[model samples]
Target: MSVTDKDRDILTRTLWGEARGEGLAGQIAVGWTIRNRVDDGKANSWWGESYAGVCQRPYQFSCWNKSDPNYAYLSGAKPIPPREFAQAQIAADQVMAGMVQDPTRGATHYYATSMPKPPVWVKGAKETLRLGHHIFFSDVP
Candidate 1:
């Protein structure tokens, strides 16, 4: 255990909550979006100050919301599936260590493909990449 142990753990859980069904590459893409926010080169970024902050930021990753089904598991009230969690950990480690290419191309925003329509913020945003069931975006401002 170390200073970033919790950060890594939260990031891993986030990957699992948000992209577990998408498999390794999907988790990695989601991880890079978080990493991009963390390294967005701004003091006190709106995205949040750290990995955990960004992941748990209100309304950002729906999984962390108390009402979301994944919240209990991420919060430890419920246990995550060992095998799926292990895959998320690998994706988190790769993104955290900068060991994988950013498939989203520095995207900081995304929406599930299942959404009936794109979120309003996407109106003027640049589409970056689309993989699995998520569509990535950048330059949201």
Candidate 2:
């Protein structure tokens, strides 16, 4: 699950409101975010550098490679396929969903889609979960 500079650049560039509004951008953002968080130490919280620091759970799990003593707990095996990546995305989405508010405050909610309109409030946080499954899990190219 080693992340590269390209991955970070892609996530940072694509995870913005404009890119997120577009479904494809949103999907890639989510995927790239998950991968970067795991490989690097980036946090995906709404506040980039607020009290909420970057999440490190993914990094902890990614520490284990096939040769590492704790590899089993880190991940099942090498080269986690797209399906597995999607599963991780879903799990991350579930966690993120819990953090979102229905009538979100200005600072509490963050948009991930790149739709043409202004920042559209997420109708339902579950949309992220569905997106995770569809983009990361499905075999769509």
Q: Name the top TM-score candidate.
A: 1
Q: Report every candidate's CA lDDT.
A: 0.93, 0.33
Q: Please list the residue runs of candidate 2 whose C-alpha ends up more than 4 Å from where it truly belongs after superposition.
A: 1-78, 99-141
Report the error of model 1 at residue 123, Å: 0.5
Candidate 1 matches the true fold with a TM-score of 0.96
Write one digit per residue (lDDT tens) for candidate 1, span 1-141.
122887899999999999999999999999999999888989878988889888989989999999999999999999999999999999999999889999999899999989899899998899999899999999997
lDDT for 45 (candidate 2):
40
Q: How far is candidate 2 from the true structure (C-alpha RMSD, Å)?
A: 14.5
In model 1, which runs have C-alpha deviations exceeding 4 angstroms? 1-3
lDDT (10s digit) by residue, model 2, range 1-141: 343444343233223211223344344434343433343334554323311122222222122234544344333334434553444444334323433222211112233223354233344333223342222221111
**Candidate 2 TM-score, C-alpha based:** 0.22
Clashing pairs in 1: none
Estimate the TM-score of every prediction. 0.96, 0.22
Worst 10 residues of 1 by lDDT: 1-10
